[model samples]
Target: MRFSLWQPGRLLSKKNVKGWVRLTLGDMGGFRNMKSKWAGKTWGTLGDSITAANGYQPLVQDALGFSRVHNYGVGGCPMTAGGERDYGATTHVGRSIENTLDCVTIFAGVNDFRLDKPLGAIGTLDPCTFYGAYASLIEDILVKNPLCRLNLWTPLHRDKDGYDIHYVNAAGYRLCDYAEAVAALGRIYALPVLDLYAQSGLNKLTLSNFTTDGLHPNEAGHRRIADMAISFLRGL
Candidate 1:
């Protein structure tokens, strides 16, 4: 079924054929354009972020020679399942309670990072709280589908200026703190982590070229992420 996407008898090139798969899964990733008030002002979503496309799912499919992919990313959503805003409950647009995925990549925390909440110690607080939210979500996934491989993904580096505008911590914690928390969780759970924040060569100066608004990645950035994810999934 996967090889049908790259038939020599067909007219399209292999790259174009693969691109079609990307486009199809892109929408399934829940790329949203939305704005709402949070603290008495309008806040906008990272409408063009490609975390799903650049995530392990599609890249693994492509590298493993499969043409189709399943993406469960929900735009503008945090991993806080039963916490504060309770976004996770309704944000699971693609993942089903019964369906079993071959692999589940935990690539949330961007919105939480943007929220700039102080990091918490893992497994010590309510599972619905900031860091605990991730643990709760992971536990649920594993409990529901124990056979599926699980991976943790850190969000890519954000522009220094962008971070300053969107994030703040009284204790001087920065975006890297969130990434570190994610890596720490991966260590506790013994799950493989793709630290895009430290690994991806995106910085304040070069972020504009890779990202659309110094936050959401552009096509070039997505390509870089896809390359990294393909390598990661292949290794697994």
Candidate 2:
């Protein structure tokens, strides 16, 4: 079932939607495709509770043999920038800004979308908005670590009693909106994107086996995440 419930009335018009459906993001013009060998590269991850749980990172590192791994994830964090101790991506990302990690993978947007934080206009680099926060974060990483490779991972499928992939938050946006934003940023930045939301294969049927409480992944789920991440990082 397809849902078109964009906020502020027609965020994506029928024509725009058709065009979007027709466009292949990976093949879009001007995308450099951030695919490179990841073995032995120093890695950094920034995200929220699921990441803070320390589930999949170790698995990924062990499989890929990362020389070093820095976990900057904090529980209940959002991608949008905010005050100190707010666990925002911009804030957490600073932990490794000076390290110039060889590779950085960001898995965020769930908290932002779930909290209904403002998703700034596309192409905007302001920190107050979701898209802007991401754009700003990416720009900072690239500027600071000129040789750093980056990847963006979309939020995984949600399956709470009152929430699912199609659930639209109070901000008049669904989970896919945030996922698409990650893809849009990937296209704009010419970076690789591991579309976990669409590709995680986590859904109602698999939630119990893959997740602990419908939102966070369990050991098995983390392994699944590692499996997919391993492939994605290797191919990149």
Candidate 3:
């Protein structure tokens, strides 16, 4: 069966359509005039930002005037490129769109670059391959709703001695490579790309800024990321 929208003043059902139909108070021109109250105002984020305990929600609400936001980022998710079978099916790409989100931020690729194990195992993510997969995902999302604006974030920074450094070392995918690849994808799709890898000053800050695990950010780090994102949105 197929579902279709019920135009405001138009007839609810026509002979051409066979499925079910529902009617609502048509567009009253309110939807067009109805600004988000936070339009040009609200900012949204999705990703592992919650794991950081960064007080990102409050910071975003206060700093960006975004009263409504959704955070769907799960730790260890790699942009949903490894297929649903991998990663315990926690990725958001395959999920159905629930709301008309204004801005969607995607923070992925770290896990894809950190698949290290015994027997010389490591992640195999080439920029070209990643871009192709990423583009496909973006296209799928746009097909669902062309009005949703997207902000694709590049992978964060990591030192040579980090736990997952082997993947980067073995694949020769430096932070710059990841940033450039994501930026290229953004340009190709006309989506806004946020260079968190370059913009986030985690390195300049002391180790205290990061979580005890030395990978995820601490509360301070979350605030920093939120601030940067808010600034970028405002500028836009």
Top candidate (TM-score): 2
Q: Residue 191 of candidate 1: its Cα lDDT?
A: 86
List the candidates' TM-scores in order: 0.67, 0.80, 0.65
How does model 3 fare in lDDT?
0.55
Arrange candidates by lDDT, descending.
Answer: 2, 1, 3
- Please provide, for model 3 over 1-236, each residue's C-alpha lDDT reduced to its tens digit, 9 standing for 90 to 100: 33355666665565655775643445422343243344443334545533224365666565555646665655555543444424422234424444467666666655545542111111222223455545665665677757777778776665434633224434556445556666877887888887877777655344355544556666776677678876776565
CA shift at 229, candidate 1, in angstroms? 0.4
- Per-model lDDT: 0.58, 0.80, 0.55
Instruction: For candidate 1, write residues 1-236 as lDDT tens digits.
Output: 13223456665655565555423444433322111111121111111135434443343343444333445555555654444545443124323544455655667666666655546667753544456766665666677777766778887777544464245655356777777888988888888998888888887778889978877777777777778876775566
Clashing pairs in 1: none
lDDT of 2 by residue, 164-213 (tens): 87788888899899999999999999999999898888988898999989
lDDT of 1: 0.58
Question: Of the candidates shown, which would achieve the greatest lDDT relative to the real structure?
Answer: 2
Name the lDDT value of residue 230 in candidate 3: 67
Residue 43 alpha-carbon offset, candidate 2, angstroms: 0.3
After superposition, the stretches of candidate 1 with alpha carbons farther than 4 Å from their true spots are 1-49, 52-60, 81-85, 88-99, 160-167, 170-172
Tell me which residue pairs clash in candidate 2: 35-236, 36-236
